[model samples]
Target: MKKSDVLEQIRKIGLVPVLRAESESQALALAGAIADGGVTCMEVTMTVPGALKVMARLAKERPEILLGAGTVLDAETAKECVGEGATFIVSPAFDEKTVSYCRAHEIAVLPGALTPTEVIRAWDAGADVVKIFPASAMGGAKYLKSLKAPLPNIEMIPTGGVSLATAHEFLDAGAYALGVGADLVDTKAIRGGHPETVTAHARKYMEIVKGFQAGCLI
Candidate 1:
């Protein structure tokens, strides 16, 4: 998908499921569960084992869902993930090399940033969006809201401590979208071999987010 299209989809969905799978099989199942729950965007973090291979499988098999690689720290991994069919890229920390690599390749990049300086640096580095990592530590929605006054143009995705209940608050506070991990996709449920539980949890979050978007609670 085109970068513009991917960004638009992320804005529409309001939340992107972040998955860390121990194996390819588990990743496949997680992808299916998220997709089934009405969320078509996912971020597969490289922290998990076989992340690249799992990302490749999801890209090839689940063409309907937008696939992104998260926790990307360097140029090599960024290049490999994009080549393997990552529609977009995300990083835990601001990395100039990684951002430059994505920009050179014309792939969308969302590098994690905290302060205004870091956020601006990421944008200046050509990041499609700046992820506010551990946003809760920075004061969550209130922090994002504070930045809007001075840096309204910076697109941000608040990850870490973003829950289904507070997802809309971040969006309303000026976040472009949210990168949800454990809150949306229960790792314990998945590890327990209850993929359906994951699906159900995803569906609940999706409904809450979609409802807020539609301006109808019920």
Candidate 2:
């Protein structure tokens, strides 16, 4: 999908499941479970072994879902992920080279940034979204709200410390979306082969977001 369309989908969904799979089979299963729960945007972190292979498989098999590569740290990895069908790239820190690579490839990039300076720099470097790493450490929703007055156009996705309860808070605070990890997909559940727990959690979150949208319409 095009970058703009992917971004729009993410905005509408209000949450992106950040996943880490140990094997290709597990990765596909997790993707299926999340997709079934109404989450179409996923970020498969590169921290896991054989991440590239898993990403490639998901890209080929699930053409409808928007696949993103996360934990990308360098230019080479970013380029490789884009080639492997990553519609968007995310990093834990702001890297100019990685941002450049994504922009050159016409793929969306969300480089992690904490302070306003880093956020602005990432935007200047062409990051489609600036991820606020460890967002909870800086007051989470409150911190994001502080930036809206000055940088309303800078799309920010708050990762780390975002839970189902606080997901809506982030969006209401002007975050483009929430990047949910452990809280949404418990590692123990995945390792124990009970992906249904993750699916249930995803469904609950989706319901909360949908309710919030409904309230807005009312």
Return the TM-score for candidate 2, rounded to 2 decimals.
Answer: 0.93
Candidate 1's C-alpha lDDT? 0.85
lDDT of each: 0.85, 0.85
| Model 2 global lDDT (CA atoms, 0 to 1) | 0.85
lDDT per residue, candidate 1, 36-116, as tens digits?
888889889898788988888888888988889989999899888888888899988999999888888778899999989
Name the lDDT value of residue 125 in candidate 2: 85
Span of 10 residues, lowest total lDDT, candidate 1:
209-218
lDDT of 1 at 216: 42
